[model samples]
Target chain A: MLDKALSGSSRYWTWVIALMAIIGIGFVFWVQQMIEGLTITGLSRDVTWGLYIAQLTFFVGVAASAVMVVLPYYLHDYKEFGKLTILGEFLAIPAVIMCMAFVFVDMGQPIRIVNVFLHPSPTSPMFWDTVALFGYLVLNVVIAYVTFGAEKKGIAPPKWIKPIIILSIPWAVSIHTVTAFLYSGLPGRGFWLTAIMAPRFLASAFAGGPAILILLVLLVRKLTKFDPGLKPIFKLAEIVTYAMLVNVFFVLMEIFTVFYSQIPGHMDHFTFLYVGLDGNTTLVPWMWTSTILAAVALFLLLVPKLRRNEKVLPVACGSVIVSIWIDKGLGLMTGGFVPTPTHHVVSYVPTLPEIMITLMVYGVGALILTVLYKIAITEREIIEQVK
Target chain B: MAKSTRRGFLKLAGVAAVGMGAKPVYDAFARRSAPEQPTPPAEALTAKRWAMVVDTRKCLREHGCTDCITTCHLVHNVPDFGNPKDEVKWVWKEQFEHGFPEQHNEFMSDDLRHKDVLLLCNHCDNPPCVRVCPTQATWKREADGIVMMDMHRCIGCRYCMAACPYGSRSFNWRDPRTHIAKIDEGFPTRTRGVVEKCNFCAERLVRGEIPACVEACKAKALAFGDLEDPESEVRDLLSRHFNIRRKPGLGTQPEVYYIV
Candidate 1:
């Protein structure tokens, strides 16, 4: 089936080459980061995490979103998703790859990363996250490959694959929940300590991940003959709208609790994000932009007439992806550190090397995504022709 | 390759369940009672919960008095990067308003408002850092409550940094060796991408000496002793003065105490 991908037009080769070029540039910077240390990034002692972690958080959502398609198709026996389930699973392959890569890049001692497994502490959320991510990656890879292989052979998927598919639904929820647990369980960080963090992570993930899926399916329709159709796409749009609504509601609840209670420790972080905190307002503009974008996205998605319009659907989905990316990827961890542990306001901005390295990680994800997607589409084309 | 039978799956699950319970059951039998008096000549291991007392009056907010801080940094080979963003401090000075955040008040005495306080790792009994450490790279010593860091084992994820409420831990963003003008042979300089913090002078303690800071304080403001010993100076000092530990209400049970 991959042989079909090998014999692509110059256009496909060009895209692959472009991703490779970006990856090469990223590799050079990565080497520099490893040698010069994370200091090359804009990260400070006060804000220990910066660009790499944000990317990790964002991709984890993307990876977990695979279950949205898988659940409806396998559990509910929704035939519309049969053609598109492989797309979600394949997209997850690269997303999980990116998730793991971002984690590696963020490490202070990348070499000692194995210590998490070798000297495993069941108590640490990081350890559990390591488990959740790697496990999810393995599950997706197996399910996608086996199902596609069966499709390529023009046979029914093996009966045993059903259990693994069933397991992935809860596994998907666990991945995001565990990622949320990473932040929410921390004792003193004012911004991330709330109980709603895990639920909020899932809500945004359900919207953001599926939003990417809708966009990817559109890309697939244009790039290949495998059109998942307007029916499946419209159904996905509905999921995105409802999930984003819940996500927005959760954010409002957080705002009410933080502001109404007026706890200085908690209020100070929100102040830094929305208003300036002690004259340090680096993230103020970005926060407001996300808020506006989220509102516009919910407005566009909630209106059924606007949602059905092909032109408006992409716009709504793109807004959701951007909005959550800013919320989870950029502001979530960094905002929590404001009025630092000592109650001093400090700021962080990613440096050029950090941004380059971050882009390289995305390029790697794109490369993996393009290859995996090409194979899935090629298999779909061959299977349809035989039928 | 037979299909996995329900009986076989259940058997595997049963074994895994028993394996998980084995550790706790063994520990229950193996656990030792708290010693009334610390075992003497236990230099190779830790003590019965180390604690400290900071006498703020004797700490002396005098001009340019960094006897404790300077001694700690110099001995530990802690680098001074001169940039706050890249700064790596093992132990440092902070204002009362900043260090004791919950205790801040606008109508407080002018002197207290301007007061300088020494801050370092609390060595909490229920350390959030330890609980959050993915690799157990940082842990509380079972013998003493001193939070220990296995620098070689640390992945530098900095989750522990986020978990700590005191801003105590510092990460080595660059090769820490780059910032040091001179080397201290007694202490091993840390590599880049590892978190470092005050260890209650765990190294010096093993040598049967007090913390470098306590010994170097000209004002004799620092006190270090075993909390388990009723006659120890730290315990005696705590009994004599009404001292406050940072974020006591968090229930971390910090071992460090300060007297105003």
Candidate 2:
């Protein structure tokens, strides 16, 4: 099946080569970061975590979103998702890889990552997050391999894989829950210290992940011989709509609790993120943009006619991804850090090297996605030709 | 032939895994078998639970005094990055409001409100930093309540930094070797990508000497002693003075106390 990826048109090769070039440049900067330590990034004493951690948080949601498709298809016997389930799993492969990569890049001592396993502390949420992510990655890889292989052979997947697929459903939820636990369970950081964190994470993940999948599937339709019918795409759009609505509702709940109660500890972070705390207003514009985009996305997705419109559907999905990306990936991390534990407001902006390294991680994800997607499409094309 | 070869390979792999696994098991057994160093040497300052009491009245008596911070940094070989962003602090001076954000008093005495209070690691009984450290790189000492950091073992994830409600821990964001004015020959300087903070001078206490900051303070603002010993100075200060712990509401049970 990998051989299918090796033979592609000039256009496919151009995209693949472009991703490789970006990856190469990013790798060079990563080596520089290792040499300079975390000082090369925007991370400081007050704002300890920045871009890498935010990206890791966002991608964890994206990786866990694979269950959205997997659960519906495997458990409910949703025939519409039968052709699309593999796409979801394959999308997860790169997303998880990107998640893991973001973690690796974020570490101050990347070489010492083995310490987490060698001297594991079960009490730590990070330890559990690492375990959950690794397990989720393996589950997806095995399921995708076995099921896709069976499809290629024109036979059913082996009986042994059923239990693994069932196990993956709960396992997917665990990964994002553990990731949320990393932030939410901390003694300080009022922005993250909420019971709603894990639920909010899942809601945004379900919204953002499938939204990304819709865009990818649309791209696949245009580029490949395989046309994953409108039924699954529209179904995914509906999921994105509801998830986005819930995500917005969760944010509103948080806002109401924070503003109405007027707890300075909790309100300070929200104020710092949405408005400016003290004189620091760097994140104000970005936060408002994300808020506006979320509103725009919700409006487009909620209207049935607009959602069904081919052009509008992609726009809504794109808005959802970008909005949630900024909300979770940028705002969430900074909000937790700023108005530091001591009430000092410090702003963080990712340096050139840091942003480059981030782009590089995305490039690696795109490259893996392109190859895996190429193989899936090629197999579908072969099946279509046979029919 | 294939089946026999496959079985042989599995057997080889099993043997290799056992060989790799034996050292840690042996090390664990060796540790359990060895005599425990349960008691400190007679000359050493032993503590059942270590604690510190900072007299802010005495601490900020002199204008712009940084004796404690200066002595601590010099003794610990803590680098002066000259910039706040990459600054590594062991002990530092912060205003009363900033030091204890939870104790927000708008109409406090002008002198108390304006004065700089000394802040360092509280070494909490229920230390969130220790609990959150994935590698067990940081832990609360069994004999003493001191939260210890094994810089060598830390992967520098900074989970401890976020978890520390007091903003005590500092990550070596850049190579610290470049910035230190003079190396403290006795102390081990840390590499970049590791977290470091005041260890309550555990090294000095083991050598029968008090913490450098406590020793250097002319005003006698900082008192360190065994909290378990009722006769100790820290106990005496706590009994006499109206003392408060930072963020007492969080239930971290900070060993460090402050007298306003």
Candidate 3:
């Protein structure tokens, strides 16, 4: 099964090489960051966290979203998803890896990372996050290996894997919940101190996660002979539609609660994000763009005609991914920091080297994803041809 | 039958016992003939819970005085990057509106409205920084309630910084050693990438000396004493004045109080 990734067409090799080049460039910048410290980044005392943390947050949702496919296929015995579940599991493997990479790069003392485990504080959400993420990653890897191997051999995945598959369902939810706890539990951070944070995270994850999966699935269809069929893709787009609707509703809920209650601590952050707080409006344009794109995505996904149209479906999925990307990856993390606890507004923008390092982590995720997908596609092609 | 002789014998015995007791006292006095005496060291300051009170009335009376800030930064070996972005501060001055934003009002007295207030780590009794620290690098000391930072253990995740409601913590964005104007050999300078802040002068308290900031304030605006002790100065001050802590509604129970 591993040998399949090694033997590929020139096009496959070109894609692999291109991701490798990105990984190489990113690695260099990461090393430079290690030497020079986070001073090279656009972070400050006020905005202590920035791009790395936001990416970690967004990718965690992507990793957890795999459960959407796994749950329907495994629990309901949905045969239409038989081909798509493996894609979901393979997608999770790199998403989790990207999450780990982002956490690694975000640390000021990356060398002392072992201290989290050595002297673990159960009180800390971050410690629980580490445990949850690592556990989810292991669960997906084992499930993918066993199930995919059984598929290649044309036998049932051993009886033992069923319980493990069921356990992953909740584990997926836990990873994102714990990640949300990392921010939401903080006392002074009014933006994240809402009961809806975990729900919002899951909703956005379900929307954004499957949106990316749809794009990857389309890419697989174009590059390989293994088609997952149209029914499963349409079903996933429907899931994206509802999840995105709920995600937007959660955002509106926050807005209503903050504005109605008229708490300066809570209202100030939303004001900073949507409009300008004081004179600083760096995130205003980004926030509005995310809002408009989300509206566009919801519009595309809601209409059955546009959604089923393959060409327009990809456009909708792209819109969902970008919309949620800006919402979670750009706005969410930085918004919490602005209108700093002191009531002074400070904005953050990622530096070039910081962006480079972030891209490097993404490149690593892409490389792992490409290789895993290549292997899965080749196996699916062989099985279809024999049938 | 021998009463006369027995009485004389009893009297002699009583005199001998009295002489025996008095002999050691006389000997002790004769041995320490010198006037000079060795003095024992002052006892290390101990408090069930340490707290500070900033008398804003006294603090603002003298304008443009950074005595406390200078002394604290110098004593702690805090670096000056000459810019706010990379600045590492232990004790610093913050404006009244910014320091106590919750307390700020539109129609406040002008004297109290725009005055500069001294600010440092609140060392909250329910410190969120301690609770959120993944590595247990920052913790509220069980003995004195001072939030302690173990720089070596901090992975520089900055979760503590984010969790701190008062904005008390500062991260070493660069090598702090590079920017220190003069290094204090007594206090260890922090390396780049670890979150650090005011330690409430735990080191000074061990040597039976007060915090440098409190000592440096010429106006005597800063009061440091045990919050738990009813007899302590801070406790007495809190009882007298209408005081406030930054973001007290958050329930962090900040030990630092402002005497409004």
Candidate 4:
């Protein structure tokens, strides 16, 4: 089965070699990070967390997005998603793995990650986040393996696995919710202290995550002979639309509250991001670009004619992903730190080493996903042959 | 058993009698309803929740109090960056305007030009860092109410660093071992990419020693003591002089008090 799948790609080795080279480059950068410390990163006291954490935040959403297709197909009995759901599940395995890796690289001591379990503090949101992330990873991997094994046998998945599938729908939501709690629970950073943070995170995750997945499905269809039906893709796009609307609404609500009360604590962060505060104007362009992209993406997605068009659909999805990446990933983390308690502006830029390590982490995730997808595709081909 | 030592036997009997007599009294106190007596004055308590009072008014920015920062960093094995970008400061001096933006008034002195005040972790009564830390790596000690970071448990997500409004937390983006070769071998160097900050010298506190910064203060501008104890030196200082906390409007209720 594996050999059959390998035969389908004449240039498979070339792709593998290229991925290996990228991974190797990333390894050298990791060594640099270990030796030089985070000083090699653009982070400073003002922006203590930068690209690594931002990417982690973004990918957690991607992992959760797997549920958009998984729930409808597995639980709702949406047969249109039958062929595509496996891809989503397989994609989640590597996405979650990357989520964990991003977090690992962000840590000062990755080995001490075990201390979270050893001496757990239930009261801390960080503890709950760890629990949720690890739990979700376990669930996704277990469910994927079980489903794949059943598929290889040309049989319905075991009765016991149905409950796991149902449980995963909520678990997917929990992972992103807990990740948001890691931010919103903070008391001093007024920007992150909002009650709506967790919900907004979920909304944004549902939006950007599914959009990326839709784009991925198109890529898979183009590259591979496997054709997941267009109906499921359309439905997923609809889900992305609603999620994006909620995300945009929640952001507007934040803006309204900030402007309505005119409270310095709430308004200061917005001022720093959109308008310069104390003459510091670094994030203004980024914020404006995100705002405009979000608007354009929403406009394109809301129109049925535009959203249905293949060319327009990918563009809309890509725009939303980039917009949310900026809004939640870069803007959210950095904006929260601006106008520091001292009302001083401190900037964070990802240094070359930090960027390289980030690229390496991404490559690692892609490599894992590529291997997993290859195996699943081979197994499907074997089942087809047996039939 | 050999000689039936009378002194030893008597001592045991005396201890048993004291234990027996004290049992009912202890039980009675435990079983009794709440006392009707008024609460004791805040100052009379001995086990004071520790706090720091920074006299920003006396902060010269001529680098007078910088010795405190340097000594504390040296003692804690905090990394020294020859460049500002790489600097991971547990304590440092910030210009007066940067330190007290909300407190700016026209009446303030021109002599205060370029005046800087020593800044470190505020160790808030309701620290966001403590609340956000997922691994329980950062915690507020119940004994003295000081916010501390346990580096061993920290996953270095920088959540606490991002959560802190004061910018007091620092991340060790690279191995801090290189910079700490001169420090005492007892203090451990931090790994790359973990968040670290002033722990109030928790080790020194256990040894009944003052934080290195307090001991090194040239102008006697920094004070540390139990805030919960009304009679503690910090409380006394607070009462004797007007003081402000960094970002009080945020309502973190910082234990670090600055007198201007």
- Candidate 3 local lDDT, A72-160, one digit each (tens): 99999988898999999999999999999998998989998977766768999999999999999999999999999998899999999
Candidate 2 DockQ, CA atoms: 0.48
Residue B248 of model 4, lDDT score:
82
Candidate 1 Cα deviation (angstroms), residue A221:
1.2
Q: What is the C-alpha lDDT of each candidate?
A: 0.88, 0.91, 0.90, 0.79
TM-score of each: 0.93, 0.96, 0.93, 0.86
Task: Give the runs in model 3 whose Cα sits over 4 Å from its true position.
Answer: B1-42
Q: What is the C-alpha lDDT profile of model 3 across B88-192, one tens digit per residue? A: 888888788999888879999988888888889999999999999998898888999999999988899999989988888999998988888999999999888
Model 1 TM-score is 0.93
True contacts kept of 2: 0.82
Q: At residue A141, what lDDT does model 2 achieve?
A: 94
Candidate 1: residue B39 lDDT (0-100)? 55
- In CAPRI terms, model 3 is classed as acceptable
Model 4, position A363, has a per-residue lDDT of 90
When 3 and 4 are scored with lDDT, the better candidate is: 3
Which candidate tops DockQ? Answer: 2
Task: List RMSD in Å for every model shown.
Answer: 6.3, 4.7, 14.9, 9.8
Candidate 4: where is the Cα deviation over 4 Å?
A1-8, A381-387, B1-47, B61-65, B74-77, B101-115, B177-194, B202-209, B249-251
Q: Assess the local accuracy of residue A158 in candidate 4 as a C-alpha lDDT between 0 and 100.
A: 88
TM-score of chain A of 4: 0.96
Tens digits of per-residue lDDT for model 1, A78-120: 9999888998998898998999999999998999787776677
- Which DockQ values do the candidates obtain, in the order shown? 0.43, 0.48, 0.32, 0.32
Once superposed on the true structure, which residue ranges of model 2 sit more than 4 Å away at CA?
Answer: B1-40
- Expressed as tens digits, the lDDT of each residue in A1-387 for candidate 4 is 245435546466677667878889988988877666666778776777778888878888889988988988877888998877888887887888888888888776676676666556677776787788888889988888888888877888889988898999999999888888877877657788889998998899999988987998888777766667688888888998999999999999999998899977779899999997878888899999999999999999999999998899999999899999999988998888776767777787777888888888889888877777777766765667533
- Give one digit per residue, the lDDT tens place, for model 1 in B1-260: 11122333343444577656645643453344323676566655356989989998778886858889888998898998999887888778888899998898999887877788889999999999999999888989888889999897899999999899999999998998878878899999999999999999988887778899999989999998989999899999999998999988778889999988
